[model samples]
Target: MKTDDLITVLARDSSPPWRFRPVLLAAICGSIIAAAALFFAGIGFRPDIAEALGSGRFLFKFVVTITLAVTASLAVGALGSPAGGVRRRGLLLAIAPALLAGAALLELAAIPQSQWGRSLVGHNARFCLTLIPLLAVGPLACFLAALRFGAPANPGLAGAVAGLAASGIAATFYAANCDDDSPLFVMTWYPIATMLVVLAGYVIGRKLLRW
Candidate 1:
């Protein structure tokens, strides 16, 4: 076929590669399963954790609401852009985690009460360290899947999807393990974590999805 003819055909038939579907499906399913497990496991809330952090109210509901909003916003933004171009995306992703970790560290360190500061530092560090790996896995999986199957026309969409998947997984695990059933815990920790994961997704999508 002539080059121009081939180009026309490719353009006319353009669609996201088929491999992405299964990866996306797995991510979605995994997130749902994680959330369900957290809910049914009799781990409803953690007042003690909230009290320690100094905010105690409707923890589960607050986290869920905030999570939904953050995830929706990130996903929408990501979907609006194209995927690939690794260098820039990767840098952005790398910076996100660093920024999140730094912010948490600074907050924990600046607390005036030594006892409380120590407690907060321990809690935040433990939570971040443990959750970061698990949270990263979901996005990494999605990135690999996107690459294997071929990225979407919009890389941003992939980032958003991956971000949501990452956040859901992280939140489920956080709920199950942390035991801090307070609005304060969710309000503070969840947003910070989500921001990190979304940034990671954006960077990963850019680098790994490069066509």
Candidate 2:
């Protein structure tokens, strides 16, 4: 075979490469597992879980808030990707999540001294600090995976996946460590801190995974 033909064959055979799939799969699975574990650990299928679920109002709000924030971050990051050089694209992706997370953290902190306010601050701070390691782990995995496999065709999707996974892992830790089981606790503080870390992941993914 001619050299050009051989090169073409090689490229076709190893398109996007295979080495990185395991890491990406692992990151995706790990995040999902972490979220499920936290859900079970937090309330199980017990009366508390049922009661919390029964309060349809709070449950609806919680789901909507978490879903929207995650979706929005991913969308924003994905939409901003340019088709050429890496520098501008990388910076834009990094900035979006960092700004979102920082803003969410600030919003959480800015609440006044009511009972809800105090609980939000206390729980969120504890959750944030504890999940720092796990939060860092998802991005590390993503960065390594991206380096080996090249950037995903859809960065927003990657960002969303990474964000959810990071949040889920952190939430699991929060469930295991935190004594508070109130829906109010989950609704108020959990989403806020989760979004912050997700934002961090988005920023990191953009910078390190310059495809």
Candidate 3:
């Protein structure tokens, strides 16, 4: 059966109205807190976090991740609505990438080309890949499950946005623990890890949020 038809049938059989916004908000807040708790309990911040905070590279990581999280969260809201805004919301996803690319360019200009490879292959590439998704688990689950109450025009797309949002939240936490703060490393591995979550969200959303 068509997803719309399925939803219509479900809606007809259901009596109570479902408010998507509050639930989504609750899920976002709760999931972020949960992720933070898990991060602190298990991994915690890096030993040199105080020193790292003074570094531009370390602070820039937060700028990128936070911007990504905010933008992606907004896009998820746009996508979750039944109203038309798929294109605009999709464009919003680009800001994080654009910022990272600009940072990478600056890094390239500031640092010698010979050191580029070393920075890109920083010490924690594997951990970055592993932990971001590990950290994303809560946000992704909360987002997808919360979005079930929403009438997103395209569930798959909504799910993907949720993935981006999740990754952003996760990356923000992981960055605290990660000692490697090079823009090259962030640009190289962060997106790969994000794609892992996004791909997972797309596949899962196709199945779980189809309507």
Candidate 4:
């Protein structure tokens, strides 16, 4: 075939460029929803949730987790595109920590200084460490699978964002069962748990996401 004819045929057959946003949203959202369902089925909301709802501490717990989820989800989605990465500069991912730190400060000011350690060392440290990562499994897998559809220039960063998103979703679910309402508790243990997942994602993505 002539070069012109080949070019014309290829142009005629070419489809629109692939868009990953919708699928990315679906995968992340669906994983969270599924994990939430399991969480509710296995461990219902805090029995005192109605009373707890009135307190800023209780509500702030959700705020921290959900905000992390939102920002990390956005970052992960951004990283899915070849040029969408913000991790190289580390800007997008900074939002979660900054917000948490602000909350932590507010918590410190509101509570007794002597009791600071008590709030930070809430009763559920073991549970927080275990359950957050446990809940992260599905979302991490789903987010990683979603990344397969796009070209992420930094697989490790993309994967770490996915891990952050997963941990946020997981922590949100765990918050319902967690009796510790203090932002200090969340600020302390949650990051530790999420970092474990992020490390795992980095290692896994480095190996799995090679194009």
Candidate 5:
């Protein structure tokens, strides 16, 4: 083709590229909805959900998970944009962890040292590790799919944030069935499981999120 014709064609096509944030949001929300439905259908809330929700420990579980989800979601949205400034705001995700750490310390302070081990171990150590990452599958997959819509400067970090969001969603669902309401359990095992997901995200993002 002639240069003039090529230039004319290129100039004529000046439409904006598709927006990534909306796609990311939809994918994340859709995945969460699907995961929640599956979780409820397969493993509904604990038998004592009414009583559990009323308890301070039970309520705090939701607080931590929701905070992580909120902050990570914000970071994910920012990272999805090509403009690339997630670092500044991404630190906010630490709020949930910091709060949990503080609570864990307070719990340690109040309880006898002998029982600290039991509180950390809880009743669901095996199950907690298995189920949280298991539940994280859907949201992680969806977040990766969403990342495909945009160009992130650091795929690993983007993936990490995605993992964080997924972990939060997964933990929230897990909370419904988990009978162990100890802050010590949530603070310890939950973060462990979430970090596993984040590592998985980092590895996968390194491979898949590249342009």
Candidate 6:
């Protein structure tokens, strides 16, 4: 079939007019459940989680990660609409990194220079890199499949956004398991894992999301 014909088939709205947000919402919820299931099965929270919750650095991890997840998911959800509201909210994606950066600066100020290296290295760097993408597998698959229900002009961007959302979700779960709550570690390793997922999404999106 011709490219135009494929686009016509995908862009056509022959069936009843259904909302994409609700479907997107379902995808988000279902993705969470899937990721959580995989998480608990393989990696539960750190044994000291009860005590870790009291630490400001530890609690802040959730703040950054959940913000990433929410903002990216919001952007991905808007990709289906003709208005392209994702562009406006697209800046929201930076909020997580901004928060992390600010927190990292504060951490550097508060701690001695000698400790910065240790804090950045952390005990779980390898696990951090491995588990985040592993946990993101389910969410990324769901997000990619869900993208088909919408008409995103830039499928690659949409997929990358979905990857961000998936990575956020996965990182949130992995954070609980990770003992290293330093912003330095999160800033270094988490983005690497996220980029991996996003790269996969972009490559896959080019093929899978072609109208």
Which lDDT tens digits does candidate 5 get at residues 97-148? 9989988888889899999889989998888898889888899999988988
Give lDDT tens digits, candidate 2, residues 1-211: 9755754465446545354545455544554564455445543433355455555433443343344334433433333223212343454344434543554455456555365555544544564455534543544354335333534444544554455445544454344445454444555566666566667656666665555
lDDT of 1: 0.50
Q: TM-score for every candidate vs. truth?
A: 0.50, 0.44, 0.90, 0.86, 0.88, 0.91
Q: lDDT values of the candidates?
A: 0.50, 0.47, 0.87, 0.83, 0.84, 0.87
Per-prediction RMSD in angstroms?
Answer: 8.0, 9.0, 3.2, 5.7, 5.7, 3.5
Better of 4 and 6 by lDDT: 6
Clash pairs, candidate 3, are none
Q: Candidate 4: where are CA atoms >4 Å away?
A: 1-18, 87-92
Model 1 agreement with the true structure over 1-211: per-residue lDDT tens digits: 9755764565456565454445555545555565545445644445455463453323443346334534443443333323323343444344433443454455456555555434443355456445644544644464445434643455544664466546655565555446544333444666666667777677776666555
Ranking by TM-score: 6, 3, 5, 4, 1, 2
Q: How much lDDT does candidate 6 score? A: 0.87
Deviating ranges (above 4 Å) for candidate 3? 1-16
Evaluated against the true structure, the overall lDDT of model 4 is: 0.83
Q: List, residue by residue over 1-211, the lDDT tens digit for candidate 4.
A: 9755754564455443656788798888787887777787776788898898798877787887888888888888888865566755367567677878998899899889999999999899999998889888888988888888776767998888889888889988898889988888888999999999999888888777766
Model 6 bad stretches (over 4 Å) = 1-18, 82-85
Question: What is the Cα-based TM-score of model 3?
Answer: 0.90
Q: Once model 6 is optimally superposed onto the true structure by TM-score, how far is the C-alpha of residue 156 displaced, in angstroms?
A: 0.9
* Model 2 alpha-carbon drift over 4 Å, by segment: 1-14, 19-21, 28-150, 154-157
TM-score (C-alpha, index-matched) for candidate 1: 0.50
